[model samples]
Each structure stands twice: as C-alpha cells, then as structure tokens.
Target chain A: MALGEVFLIPTVLQDDETALESLPINIINTVRNCQVIFTENERTTRRHLKKMDRNIVIDNFQWFTIGKIEDSILDTFSQQLQLGKNVAIVSEAGCPGIADPGQFLIAEAQKINAKIHPLVGPSSILLALMASGMNGQNFHFMGYLPVDTTERKNAIRKIESMSINDNCTFIFIETPYRNVPLVKDIISNTKPSTRLCIAANITAASENIRTKSIQDWKKEDLNYLHKQPTIFLLDGGRQYAPKSHY
Target chain B: MALGEVFLIPTVLQDDETALESLPINIINTVRNCQVIFTENERTTRRHLKKMDRNIVIDNFQWFTIGKIEDSILDTFSQQLQLGKNVAIVSEAGCPGIADPGQFLIAEAQKINAKIHPLVGPSSILLALMASGMNGQNFHFMGYLPVDTTERKNAIRKIESMSINDNCTFIFIETPYRNVPLVKDIISNTKPSTRLCIAANITAASENIRTKSIQDWKKEDLNYLHKQPTIFLLDGGRQYAPKSHY
Candidate 1:
C-alpha cells in the first residue's frame, strides 16, 4: 500500500547506533522501494545501513549529484502529485529539509500542494539550539559557511554584527575534522563579550554541552575540540548553556 | 547506599507510588529518610500520592506552595547542593524549566551549582511547535497572553510585527475561551496575506494540526475556538501564519 511512491532520505549518520536503528519502519520501507535515493553521500549511507544489518539493495537507488539533485527532486515531487501520492525527503543526518540540502526540494513541495511530513528524532542541530537557550525566540539556521579561511571569517563577522539582545539567533554547524579550527576562528573573531556554546558528539557518551563567554574561552584551549565531533552555537551576548560561569 | 540523599521525583502519580512502595521493604530506606518532596502543585501532588494507596507518613516531606515556591526552591537547592546530595523536582505535565512554573527553581538551582536533570516526556509546547512547521529555528514562548482584549491585541501586534521569514518564530498560547476573538482580531488587524497556524489539543485525542493562510481562512469561522488547551504558533508573514482581512 504505497500511498506515496517517491522518497528522499538523509545520508549522514550519527554517532549513536541503537537510536538510529529506531527509525520509523514505514520510512525504511519507503527508502528501500524508492527508485532514486537522492543522498549527499550514497556510499556512506549504504555503509551505515550495512552496519545496522539492514540489507537494502542500493542497485536501483541513484546517487544524487549536485547537478541532478534539484531536477530529480522537482521531477519526483511533480510526478507524485500527478499520481496522487506523497513523496518523502530525508537528510544526510537529522531531520530532512532543515540545514540539509533539501530546502529547495521542500520549498518546491510547498509551492505545489505536496504534503511534507518531517519526523522528529535525534537532531544535533535542534539539540544544540534547545540546549543553548540563548535565542530560542526568533532564530535562523544559516547552515554551514564556506571553509575558506577568509570567507569563513567574513561570514562569522557578519553573524557577529547581526547579534542583538533577545531578538534572533543564528545557528550553524562545522565538520568534525575542522571543529578545532572553527572554534579558534569563532573565539578570536567574534565579540569578546559574546556568549557561545559548543555541543560536541551530541547524544553520545562523550557529549559536551558548555556555553561560555568569548573572553573566557580565549584564555584557554578546549582540548576536547581535537578529540570529538562537535557543533558550535553562539549568541553574541545573550546567555550560556546550563553550566554556570560564576 | 543512596547515591544522593534527596530524591527529585516526577509529579506523575506512578513515580510517587513506585517510590512509596519500594521504601517499605526497608532495602531502599535511605530514600524514605530523605523525603522532603519539593513539589510545585502541592495540593494536587499530595492528592495524587494519596490516591496511590500509600499511607506513608511524610513528616519531613515539604510540599511547596506557589508563595513558598521561591524560598523553598532556594533553600532546597542550596542545602542539597552543599550536602553533595541530589534532590529531584517532580516534573509536571511535561519537561521541567521550559516555559513552565518550575523555571525559577531550575534557574536558582543552576546559580547555586545544583545538578538539574530533565527526563524525556510529553511537552505540549514542544509538540505544538514541532507540529506547526512555523519555523522552530528561533521561537519565543510568552506563556499565555492576557485574556483582556487590549492586552491580548497588544501582544498579538508585537509578535505580528516581527520580521517574517524562515528565521524567526513566535509561539504563544491563547485562552481557549478567547480563541475566537483572537482569531477575529488577527483577520481584521494583521496583514490579509499573513500566515497563521493553530495546533489544538496536541498529542491528545482529537488533535488538530493545520496551517492556513489568512486569506484562505477568512472564508470560514473556526468552530474549534472554544476548544481549550490549544496552542497558537504564528510566523509573521504573507507566507507562514498570516493575517486575513474579511
């Protein structure tokens, strides 16, 4: 009973295995039957499924490339409506259509009357946002910025300038390998009085949820940066994570 | 041996009952000796415990009140923390310290360095926010707005004027009795093209999750206005939760 035929599943994997295994069974079936699996990293997804003992046949799933990703999504979304069925989109990690590369797909889905169902699960992004408690009122997810030193620095500078008290929040993520460098850039480049939180290896055994001032951070090196997967959340001068600085 | 002297139990009757039963065997007598329960709704909490068929005499149990709420919290936090003991704050209908009455206690606990643990459970606020799709990236929970028309209208106006985009989200609950008036005001006052989403009775039977453009909604009177326990999540804009002109 495939009420919806096409599906988009995220390819990124989280550090937790047991929780990942608890994905909705219907979603797993949809992912298995979909003719095309538009994924950021098809190889990695397949490897993860294999590790989870899910023997899914990936022969028919087309690995989505940047050039064809948009068209494939648009086509599937259109066809699903024509057939009167729903299409699901999954992100490489966390919930789909968020910071993942599926916004264009979701926006298109909305433009056409296609239903977009986002299932709630382990979202490191949301975890960091909720845990940060700095600007939960009105915030924005700017996604990941360019890794080029100058470009990244410029982007951080813009975010820094935009920070206002209790107005809005800006959330972004960084690659695990580049976490250290990104932290260094954030600590040095952002305003000294600004408060920031780093949620590392979120929902894992070694999770580190700490919000602190930029000035205090600059005085020391967070040794854990080099040892784990992490995400950085900064709100110019608002608040820290649950930990007390005093 | 008791890891910590004080126990922070949830408001759930099941939790209190289990604790009451477990202590009678005297194996967990340490838990019985340190039973100064710091509860928010003292009257209701005590009643729930009594209903659980427990005759446990609680001479030491300090059922806190709304007025004593502040003092009791500070004293409990300081005492438990200094003694290197953990005190459990019986959670209410949902997670503690997020847009609920227990926040002051949690904040004071944090200030004094007392360990605060939040267990996973039903949170109407988070549930409604997620179901609304009005942008969870940044959101503000102003509790329940005043029932008076002027104050309600003013609150609505303040939130309605916020920059509408996928960046900021404003969430506030309305009195079930005044839901219709609120909706009417929205239609007449805000932009006709703004988008508004109402999630009613979230996570309960007869749940309603619908987002309609103000222009589209003006055609009918929402009959469910009288339904209590409804949540209004408005993302100001012509696209998200919009204002309609009838």
Candidate 2:
C-alpha cells in the first residue's frame, strides 16, 4: 500500500487575479488529488481553492484547522497519512510552513515517513530579498523582531552590526499596525551609512520596493507606507552604494 | 514621466512543465513590456523566455549579460531605467537577485530610484524550507559551506550548534559534484539527535524532501542523491518528536 503523502501548497498573498495568476495549473490538480487538508483557516482555504478551480466540490474533502496542532490532532494527521489518504496543507497567506503554522504537521508527516512535496509559489521573504539589492548569498530572515520598544531598538543595532560583520543581509517583518514604529526605530537606531530596502505590499498594485540610506530616508515623507504589509532589509556591507553615496 | 522600472523575473529551477508551470502568466506580459533585459546567461534567458512564449521575438529586446557588472555596464543599466525604458533581469535559474548575479543591476536601479517588482516564482531555498519541517520563523541561509574538508566540518558543527542555541533552521547548499562529501560530513559531524533535511531536485521529477536524525540517516544508504542539486537544512530544536521519539 502506498503511504499517504503530504503536499505543502502556497496561496496568494493578495486576493486578486495578479497574485492568483502566479500559481501553477498543477496546484488545482494537486488539490483535486488530496482527500484531506490541514489549513491555517478553512474559510480562506476554501475560497482560494474555489478561485483556483470553481468546479472543485468544497464539501467532498475533510478539512482540519492547524492553528495549534495538539498531540491528538498530530495523531489523527499522521494516522490519515498512514491510511494512504494524501493530505494538503495550506497557509492563510503565501507559502505554508515559513513564518507560518504549517511546520508542525510537516514535522509529523516526516516522522511517519510520508512523502512530502512542496509546490512552488510566491514567498514574500524571497520576493523582498529579490528586490532588496542586498547580499543574497548569505542572509538571515529574523521573522519578526522583539515587540518591546527597547528590545526592538537594540535588535536593530545588533542586526545592523551583524550585517556589516558577516556581509549578510538581514530581513525582518513587523505587524502591519506597528509598521510605522518599526521603520522609525530602524531609522533612529541604524547608522546613517547603512543601506535599507523597504518593500511594501509585495505583489500588489501598490507594491513598492526602494533602497536608501538611513540618513536619506529621514529626509523623505514615508507616512503613506504606514499600516501596509512591508518587509525590511538591511545590508551594511556596502555591496552597492546607496543613493546618498551616488 | 514615471521612471522605467526593474522587474526581477524568476525562472524555472528545472526544465520541465512542473517547474515552468510555477511561473506566473503575467511574466509574458512583463516580458512584452520590457525593452531591455539583463540576464546572468543570455542564451539560457532566451531559451526560458522562448519556452514561456514562443511568439516572443527573441531579437526584439536588447540583451545585456551581467557576468561582471563593470562601472560602465552599471551606468548603462541605470541610464536605461532613467530614460524610462523598463528592463527585466533574469537569473540562470530560479529567482534573480537571490543567490544570483542580478543584485548589482537591482542596486543600480535602486540608486536611480527605479521601481522594482519581483514577480512570484519557484525559489529552491523557500521550497526546501517549506518542506523541511524545521524551524522556519528564524532561519539562516548560509548559501554554501567551505570547500575544504576541515573548514567544512567546522562550519557544519557551528551551524548545528547555532540551530540548537537559537532554535533556528540552518540551510546551505553544495556543488552538485561535492554533494556526497558534504552529506558524509553532515552525518559524521552533527549530533545524533540533530534533525537534518536533504531536499534534492526541487520542482523536478525526482524531487525529494526528507528529514531525519543523524543516527537514523547513518543507517540508510543514500548514494543515489549524489551529483544532484540539493538544499540541506539543519535544525536542532527538536520542534517535533523525531521518528525514534514517536
């Protein structure tokens, strides 16, 4: 008997055709091949699946939430795999299991010796890195910084220093609402010479990616970026001269 | 007039429908809109673009090779953007500007304040992380480890320790031919309990992603994975119970 497999599916970051059109046709076929799914949110998962394939019967497959995969849920998930029922795991946005809650089930699937296939899709971190004009050979995705104001500032300084010392790019995200404060903290804490890349609303119509030095950014009016989903990148290696230097 | 923008285009990792299908349909439109393209390899970029749209006249657009972005080429790239000529940048494989040579051009675009759009596509690193079942929130991509035996072993040990100390996943890649030695080094140097995921031929026909403890992996025969492009992940957090623990 074939062991049930696990498929890691990536969903669109924004709800639009532009983002939707990025997905492969295989995604719909992969969805159809699965009998059970573990998703970050069932409602959004169904909506995305329907958008991919309106003909897909929403009620035919069993759905489970992966908010917090307790031991019991883990047991059932692994059991289903052992029973030869392929399962799909979808995150609320973007790719699952990266800065998301899909890793727990993936770990369980590995333990049970289930085949795992991670389909392709947009990853905001990767997208942000792609346009940052920073070091790509070596980089660190810090996920999110410490929320405490003092800790966050200290982290910014440390990250800046590390970026210089290692010649590595540092990427971090902020809560949408706290985006303004985070940017302010970055500007205040980092060196004036350090290069910063602000990538906001990635893959959206208003998507913007710009690189500037901390000092140059202080002179600009950037309040419009507040509350937008943004990814920050800092590369202190002077790989490329920032606008100020130019 | 709005300045011409830079689009960081992502290409297929493997030359197959499964790999090519992951790219967005908008890529063709993006290609049509661009008047100039800076690519790592001009021939391969032409092949990939032709694969996406055969009707795309390969000679219609000016091609620039980013083998070594001298000051002269950098000036030309930025000048083209400043003149309102949209340009596309394509890497040899996967997404450009991420572990590829496209960042220099992106940096030049940034210096000139050109809008940058990183379209969605398959990234082997992100794909590997998605399927690694390891700590994804805090991870470091070391890119490539040292080639020397002693330095490589020391690097592996340090990476393993860092994974344990920070509960972070450590990802690194190896040259295709050196894959076997790297795997041997990993199994011999890492702790018996440290979890390592070997993801090979991502988005290809023989794609495989599996995680196991050093002890468990030592018992298996995996010589077949040699000479294949692969991504290795090490996470010592024990985020979930290993197969032995289960």
Steric clashes per prediction: 23, 0
Against the native complex, each candidate's DockQ, computed on alpha carbons, is 0.10, 0.59
Per DockQ, the best of the predicted structures is 2
lDDT of 1 by residue, B34-104 (tens): 44556567666566455543675655565554334445456655565566555545444433444444544
Provide the clash count, candidate 2.
Answer: 0
After best superposition, candidate 1 residue A180: deviation in angstroms?
4.5
For model 2, which pairs clash? none
Tens digit per residue, CA lDDT, model 2, B88-188: 99989999888886888887778778889998888889999999888889999988999999999999989988888988999999888888888999999
Residues A1-246, candidate 2: write the lDDT tens digits.
788999988899888767786776778888899999999899999988988888999899989988766787788898889889999999999988898868888988888789899988878899989998888989999889999999998999999999999999999998889888889999999889899999888877878888998999999887877789899999988576434323
**All candidates: interface RMSD:** 10.2, 4.3
Top candidate on lDDT is: 2
Cα lDDT for residue B233, model 2? 91
**lDDT by residue for model 1 over A58-135, one digit each (tens)?**
565555532234455567656654565544455566555444445445445444444444333445554555445455
Model 1 alpha-carbon drift over 4 Å, by segment: A1-13, A17-72, A78-88, A101-118, A129-195, A213-219, A226-246, B1-71, B81-91, B101-161, B165-169, B235-246
